[model samples]
Target: MLSSGVLAGSASVQGPQGEVAQFEYSGSMLRINAAQNDGYALLRDGHFYTVGYNNGQPMVFDAGAMLKGFGDMAPQAIHGDLGAEIASLKDTGENEVVAGIQGDVYEVQFIDDSGAQRSESLVLSTDKRAQELRDALFQMMNFAESMTPGQEKAKAQSQDIRARLSSLNAGILRYGSEVTVTEISGEPVAAQRFELPAQPLDLQGLGKLFGQ
Candidate 1:
């Protein structure tokens, strides 16, 4: 295991969620420091818990505090791009609004001071950046879905595009830090499971577009 307080690699965020923020992992701890007033949580032992938040708000957790389920519950299948989106918003407080367009969606939700929750939805097309990424990912999924069995060429192409998108790091958008893509029963599947950092990040100014 790594020593305590080791400076692991960093990741940034982008899109509507704000900045990339910094992430550090050392020993048995993982830390996420957001650029704006953002926050993050972890799923351990079948429970989801908010380990830290920007702006200094006391953390809270329920018996089952996981994010929306992806496997069967996701609006669409979750993949590397989706992982990037989640990491980007990992620190942007609860969303206060949400919207979707033609299968693309945007949501803004947040927990209030009294613990009440509020959210909104809009046609995802309204946000250029959000719509572009959402559409692209959805298009990839749609293509995969529509592919007939034994269409190896098309499947290969789709995975190529997905990997290409996963490589771009404009700001703090982090994805694929530890990703596994495989073929399961003739279907493509991806998983995001990795250790996290244990300290806050300096989101003010980040270096390099994307690291090696």
Candidate 2:
């Protein structure tokens, strides 16, 4: 529905600790600058880059390995594709205003990779502006999924969901309680915003920091 060009926006993400995080996206890149932490994350070009500061020293690392490592440490029972959990999506024929945009409400049913059932609600709009923003967000999601390990099944499921949404000419305005688009603009973003501030540290360099 977007005639052409890129969409820029910022969202408010509710953190687990009752704190809010700002998420900015432009084109295919998303940036999360932590407000209370010494690190930030950027998702660009099919990779997630994490930058952290230790005693005023900056360290850049690949996020894929960190995610895999976290998965390895988790209990096996919870090791499932979180992205492939959505089982169905249905329009509820209800309208709601989110962030000043009116959109139709939809219910999403989820069957976790472990087969547990859950559900959530989302507000979707068919506005051209919203569609442009949605496309940018979708691109980031695709890039993030591409870099994740062992996600082929989840990727397939995600593709199906994307197709279904596209068929309805819908774009997300709000996704349950997790994300809300607080502001949007058609402004141009600089290419350098997606560039890494420094080279990522190699595995050896990372291990050296821990005296491994």
Give the candidate number with the greatest lDDT: 2
Supply every candidate's count of residue pairs whose N, Cα or C atoms clash at under 3 angstroms.
39, 0
lDDT of 1 at 97: 24
- Residues 1-212 of candidate 1 have per-residue lDDT tens digits of 11123222323333343334443322222333455655554333333344454456544442121222111222222332332211111223222222211222234343333556554332222233332333323342543234223434334444543443334311111222321111001111112322323433322122111110
lDDT tens string, model 2, 32-114?
76778857888876667888888888788876444444432222212233255577899999999876779999998878757
Q: Can you tell me which runs of candidate 1 are displaced by over 4 Å? A: 1-7, 16-18, 27-29, 43-48, 51-57, 62-65, 68-71, 74-212
Q: Model 2: which ten-residue window has the lowest total lDDT?
A: 72-81
Clashing pairs in 2: none
What overall lDDT, based on C-alpha atoms, would model 2 receive against the true structure?
0.65
> How high is the CA lDDT of each candidate model?
0.30, 0.65
Let me know the TM-score candidate 1 reaches against the reference structure. 0.27
**Cα TM-score per model:** 0.27, 0.72
